[model samples]
Target: MTVRLDHRRVGLDRESLAAAYPSASASGRVVVVVFLHGLVETERSWFHRPRPGKARNGTDFGSRLAEDLAGTPVYVRYNTGRRICDNGRELADLLAELVEGWPVPITEIVLIGHSMGGLVARSAVRQAGDHPTPGLSKVTRLVCLGSPHTGAPLERGVVRVAGILGMFAALAPVARLMALRSDGIKDLARGSLHQDHRAEYGRPVDAGLPAGVRQLFVVATLSRSEGSLWGPLIGDLVVAPSSAGDRTQTADLEWLGGLHHFDLLSHDAVYGVVAEWLRT
Candidate 1:
């Protein structure tokens, strides 16, 4: 489960960095915007079909941000089957390498993540704290879209059902099949950030967001009104709104109704909120 830069699998070597970021090298002290994709997804997921009347090319959020904001947009692709913490550790190292190898100085970094990617970002921040990752100081903001911060009900349900099935010898095979899910998927049961927190699944962890970094939690619901019965119950068809934004009272929160989990990936409304927050 390797994490590479963009779809081209850009390496972190000095030569690759020089080739990939020549323009950034020419620019002075630029902000770096990193986009982290969700579970079972690649960086290409950000490239949605072009919106009508909008630009015909570069339809992804990263592309749009490059045009609107004064920053370098970097899309990271990784294997989703690995544990979140494992990926997070690697990501922290990768970012540190990027900082060390960048052609120009970096002023700040903004992380925008979707679904499981958000959890990975948080874990990366936490892992960065254990060591002196120079790039960690530059992370100024983190944006989570439909992330299961507290936990995801679907994962919990699957675990429960798998347990029940395991009790019956006749259904043990099916139970084992369900348990064969990737470690990354299993981490969603409680949004376990640290390795030690895995045992405390039923209880919520108080691992707060990184200090000095602005945080934004964006939740999407299929219901027209978030206050409706289905809103919290079927949030984005994967994550619960309460779990997604329950981490901090200080972080900015946005609840978008009548949208599913995947919709947040390319939704204009989501981009508007992100752009506005970044601008401020």
Candidate 2:
């Protein structure tokens, strides 16, 4: 993940994928936990020290999740500028290949995605049914952290504001900065999963997740409560709680009182909830 986090290694070839992982136990059953990152972020962002420098906290999602859970932890790194559904389809194939080459027999596949990655994870799971990927049959759980299931209004607003700003002569530079978003971010504007993306790119439909798979949505907020003054206006500084975690699904909800979008990555409360869920 550290290497893949680099801009130079962003387009890693298939040959190098296996090298990213250390060998898992050869005999015992294993579970694969894939951590997909958010928009405009690298795999290293999950660890909280996004830059190339050494980490200060002496703790990270990779190290902590590995210690808390008995499984192989994998960080998925990709070009965030590309179409998310395209990446989703590629990820489905990549994961199947990973299972084929893994040392131990993988008993389960767990997908944890944040923001844009969540849409990719869901789309990948949907697309897998059509192509019949190897490891997909083992998929048992999906955890989406601060995902904008409905849409990412922030990205949408940025797009619109940039378009408006471009008309003005003096604000062209600011417009350029605001308009420097990727197709993946545009996809998040509507929260378009691969299936819906067919309308956008003339792609085919992707549907169905493994039946009875444990699905958990982790929602966070900047304000103390959703009813608070800033809660709906600026949820987690990116996604709304209603979008991150469906309030309707009372049984399947965990509400973190005051956390930003990236806070869920390596926070103790988040890890504890995930650990307990996996244990069950």
Candidate 3:
């Protein structure tokens, strides 16, 4: 019943590029930073996707973040198809395994997630629980960029339609396959996401963020020109800024103006703030 999309497609370029410029395995001396993209986007979208005329969202965010954190080690996650919980669990497991098996010592782990990726990172931290991998405890900061902690109201109609259709899909095979995207969205709506369960998403500060984790929310505010008919009124046209703030009063939230949903990742202004946060 869990939907897992093909991430292998997004990572092909990265793999080939790595092969072309293979570096020594990062010794534990490296500061490990993981970048997670939003839904319906691939890893290639972070670095390769080019807009013929205008500056696209997220295009430069990853590159700039990596460049700014030049001395530190970083990994950008490519998967965008699975349910948020499934992705979070997988990422948590992968990080635990990677850190434990790494050839060198890992000094720190920083998680940076944009939009839905932010929700997944928070969920993954919860999944890490007390049985956390030894080195993972060193994770000092979690940054959520343009994430909808309170859920976006614009997708409400789509969510409703998906729920009705999802009920019928339970009776048919092809229907289930056809409803994958909707189901995934529904799961996000029902799970510990910003839009659906504000309490669950915000509970981390006291119940899940552990002792020393510095939680930061980087909200992107978009203008009316950025979205379509169903675009958000207050957000990056996708997620509203109101939904991006902390409900638990534990996180330090900062608003980054003039960014579209994707611009939060690519724009220099937004990137500057993120880079500064990572350094601190």
Model 2: worst 10 consecutive residues (lDDT sum): 198-207
- Pairing residues by index, what is the TM-score of model 1? 0.92
RMSD of each: 2.3, 5.2, 6.6
lDDT, candidate 3, 1-280, per-residue tens = 1111223322223344244223315443566666777776644444533334234353465445445665333445545555666677677766765465544556777888878778777767755564575645767778888776656545554545555667764645544554556433544443353223433321323326667777788877755343434334557777766667655636877776656777665566666677787677
Q: Score residue 231 of candidate 2 by CA lDDT.
A: 84
The residue ranges of model 1 lying beyond 4 angstroms of the native Cα positions read: 1-6, 50-58, 247-250
Pairs of residues at least 3 apart in sequence or in different chains that clash in candidate 1: none
Against the true structure, candidate 2 reaches a TM-score of: 0.80
Alpha carbon deviation, residue 251, candidate 1 (Å): 1.9
| lDDT against true structure, model 3 | 0.59
Per-residue lDDT of 108-185 in model 2, one digit per residue for the tens?
888888888877887788776677788677777888888877677687688789989999999999999988877877
Between 1 and 3, whose TM-score is larger? 1
Deviation (Å) of 195 in candidate 1: 0.8
132 in model 3: Cα distance from truth in Å? Answer: 1.6
